[model samples]
Target: MHRTPCTVHGTDDRDVTTVCRCGCGEALPAAPAGGGRAPLYASPACRQRAHRRRRPVAPTTPADPPSVAPLLAQVRELAAVLDAGGRPDPTGVRVVEDLTGRLLARARSRGQTRWLPWVDAAGRERTALDDGDVEALTARLYADGARTVGPPQPSRPACARWVQAWRRDTSPGAQTYAPLELVPGYPLTEVDARVLVQGCRDGGESWASIAARAGVPVAEARTRWG
Candidate 1:
């Protein structure tokens, strides 16, 4: 871990080995880097000992956890059935089982495994996803470890963005919201402008930045809006 690549065989070179690296000075086969890097440590113990001497390089940016929204939704549906004192519908149960298996296989392919959720929820042999297993998967996906018997709470679904309005009144007289691209002299209003600005903020746009683009100073913008 600490020692540099074998001066003779660097990482880019194939099938060659470096020294014991712990300075053991033995000629062992390089670590099992198929065609990648020349091996560095001789054995697990050697690598670990080197690790203790100094930290090994930090790992790369980790992969994001796989989204199991469909699986989570199915689990919730089944849970509702169980709560109602009725056996889970056989079709729905099968769907959850199949979805879980597919998600596990997909995650394995991507090397994005956290292991505990898949292991505990459905195990290697594929059992039904129980409450605890559901919670485990929920925590993994949502990062809220304390939630028990609760489903994962992800952000507002992207479909919300496509919906023209969340307000209740759709009557023509109700003054529906303006589109993002507002044309000049479209009978626009101060209230309408404020609504649009606030909606933009709610949608994660920064008013300060938008104002800056229009050559408005931050202080002046805030004075009018805030």
Candidate 2:
């Protein structure tokens, strides 16, 4: 669609002339013998310039957060579980940690990196993550000291004792890795009984009742399950 030309007053203010929409302040000649709408610009260059100016800018949609977002969210959720003294599936934690680390490394790599290995290995379908998401995840993961992978430090004597107790109380295959040793001066919390509550949920246990039994909020229990 083209714009209809606006008429402007001739030099004597007694006649009318077509004003170029290009703002050149020049008058346009009559449209060719055919009766049609007049052109807007004096020359092709002006028409091109007008077209460029009138072109609709592509609307700026915010980029989606990286595919690592859900993974990082899982990391935060797992960290919360540990913080709350809930024992997580060892295999699950290891898988999440490795995936998060690889994602972080790939984001910083100049070379190509396989993204979200777990998603691929699980044979589950997922939406592809874009460059924007990776950049965002990298910044956030690096900022969060708790999530960043660090060098392994020798377990403190207290942490060691806590681990021994944990082993004694836990049944075979119930325990995975030891609790994080990041809290040096703080006493370790025994794995809460709620850790086993997820099992009961499948046995027709009410969510409210399971949460009460676990001594954790229902939301926390759901987060743990996720």
Candidate 3:
């Protein structure tokens, strides 16, 4: 390690003592009337203090650059598009929005819900609709004795009251079994309200999920809408 000694042109500089090259701030002998080489340091100790050698740091290897495979693939796709000798669809903005919505989900309120999109065994993406695919699935599950559908247990550790909790094969074919909602007091509802029925159906709840939440047979949930 090595360090260069700090120097300042101390000749005729009035503030040389205050701005000492070695940071000592001690006064120096006044420069001779004849201009000459200036004092380089305020004192011998200051000279040693100002000339500390800095340790050499080891050089770090640069990070590897991003892989080029994706970029090359995108360029090849663009070349094929150019070879087609036509511009892409002018109306394809809608497709971009659709794909973006599928790829990036927006934040939703607790009260809001969206329909379930599933990829069946056939590898095609499809939206699950109530009263149709939903009903068919529920009928199949109910017949299979998936009676483990019911309201959530009370949040408190110990309850004087007991509520039946769904505890069985809640698997993929039946979709996810998220406990419908936390019904604090008790599960009470207008037994046969048309608006209520319509609202529940439109709320993206499959009959299977609704039945499990209502603690009823999935068949009963399906027939209730019928």
Best by TM-score: 2
Query: lDDT per residue, candidate 2, 121-195, as tens digits?
Result: 344533433333444334332333222133365333433343333323332222122223211122323332222
Question: Can you write out model 3's per-residue Cα lDDT over 1-226, one digit (the tens) per residue?
Answer: 8965444555645454445466566776566579997766767777777776334567998653343334444455555666898565534544444433322222121232322223334445445434324445544334433322334732322221221122122322553322223122234343432233445554455677667644567887677543
What are the per-residue Cα lDDT tens digits for candidate 1 across 23-44? Answer: 5665667444657665667777
**Which residue segments of model 3 deviate by more than 4 Å?**
1-160, 163-185, 191-197, 212-215, 224-226
Ranking by TM-score: 2, 3, 1
Task: Tell me the lDDT of model 3 at 120.
Answer: 37
TM-score of each: 0.21, 0.26, 0.21
Itemize residue pairs with steric clashes in candidate 2: 66-133
**TM-score of the candidate numbered 1?**
0.21
Kindly provide the TM-score of model 3 when superposed on the true structure, using C-alpha atoms.
0.21
Task: Write down the RMSD of candidate 3 (Cα, Å).
Answer: 19.1
Candidate 2 lDDT at 115 equals: 21
lDDT value for model 1: 0.47
